[model samples]
Target: MNNILRAKNLGKVYRVGKIDIHAVRGVNLDVEKGEFVSIVGPSGCGKSTLLHLMGGMAKPTTGKVFIEGTDLSMISDGERAKIRRDKIGFVFQRFNLFSALNSQQNLEIAMQICHNGNIDHQRIKEIMKLVGLENKLQHKPLELSMGEQQRVAIARALVNNPLLILADEPTGNLDSANSYKVLYLLKDLNRNLGQTIVLITHNQEASKIADRKIEMKDGMIISLS
Candidate 1:
């Protein structure tokens, strides 16, 4: 299978006055095209950091990341930003939606931003329908339940038709029922749309939806299954 993402000797360090904290250490990961992988770990385990590195959101202190064979560390910030904008989508633990905007408007705004004003109403409708939010197009984030809000966020993430989706604890804010729904939606996306996904979560059940599960501890990967 073709590698959609790869990390070689990836590491990140943060210096606080007198000490250097290793947020990630010699970590390596690869995600195949159209494959769904989950990274599971406790808080402070560096799983989120690894996600950021892979998505070109942060520079690695030492090591390299290749996304679709482009070396992230070797690119200029503007170039990397272009790659991220065109190829990667992100879902965070919090639904970072504009509280005032309706669901459809939220997605439309994302589409404009992602495509530099080339709004695709047809594609937006398709994505909203895919995420089961076609009926709630006029509902604002505050008007919707947490699950609905997350689904809107997911729809916005898909607005640009990105090649990879990096989700960091996307179900963390929801209840068990809602979390199950969200996880199932992610799995369905992979199964139906061939969407490549890398989800970071502490929930074992949530992680199980992925094709492979990687466990991390204290800044290093401890297991892959």
Candidate 2:
């Protein structure tokens, strides 16, 4: 299979007063197409930062990230933004849904921003059913439970048919039962829809659901198996 994402000698440093805080240091990673991979680490180990870099939301201080053989470092910001809009989807732990909009409206807004056509209501219905939110489409974020809101976020991420899904601490805000529900849904997307996913989380049990698990510490990937 082709490698959908690659990071070579990636590094990011933050200058705080006289001290340098190395968030990610000389890391290398490759994620294959249609693979479900998880990055697990303690807090402040740069897992989320790494996901941002991989998704083209942030530029690395050094090294390169390639998406489907295109060098991200060489691309213009607009080009990267286009790639992000069309090829990548993001689900955050906070379930970044708009408080003012209902679930279907939120997804429609995302489709508009991404310039996505084929906005079939039937497909939207299917996704809603897939995430177990068929009855909650007209509800606002505040009206739903945490799990339901997160599922809406997932539906919005899938609306564009993105090549890669980058989830950062997707279940962090949920209880154990809800966490498993979300994780199972993500794994189902990977297994059934063949979605390539790179998930960052601190939960070891959640990480174990991935096809491959990578452990990071002190700004470096310590192990992968």
Candidate 2 lDDT over residue span 78-190, tens digit each: 99999998899999999999999999988887788787553567777888898889998899999999999999999999988899999999999999999999999999999
What are the models' TM-scores? Answer: 0.97, 0.96
The lDDT values for all models are 0.92, 0.93
lDDT score, candidate 1, position 150: 95
Task: Write candidate 1's Cα lDDT for 75-153 as tens digits.
Answer: 9999898888788988989989999899989988877777888888888889989999888988999999999999999
- Per model, how many backbone clashes are there? 0, 0
lDDT of 2: 0.93
Give me the runs in candidate 2 sitting further than 4 Å from their true place.
116-118
Judge candidate 1 against the unseen true structure and give its global Cα lDDT, from 0 to 1.
0.92
Off by over 4 Å in 1: none
Error of 1 at 130 (Å): 0.5
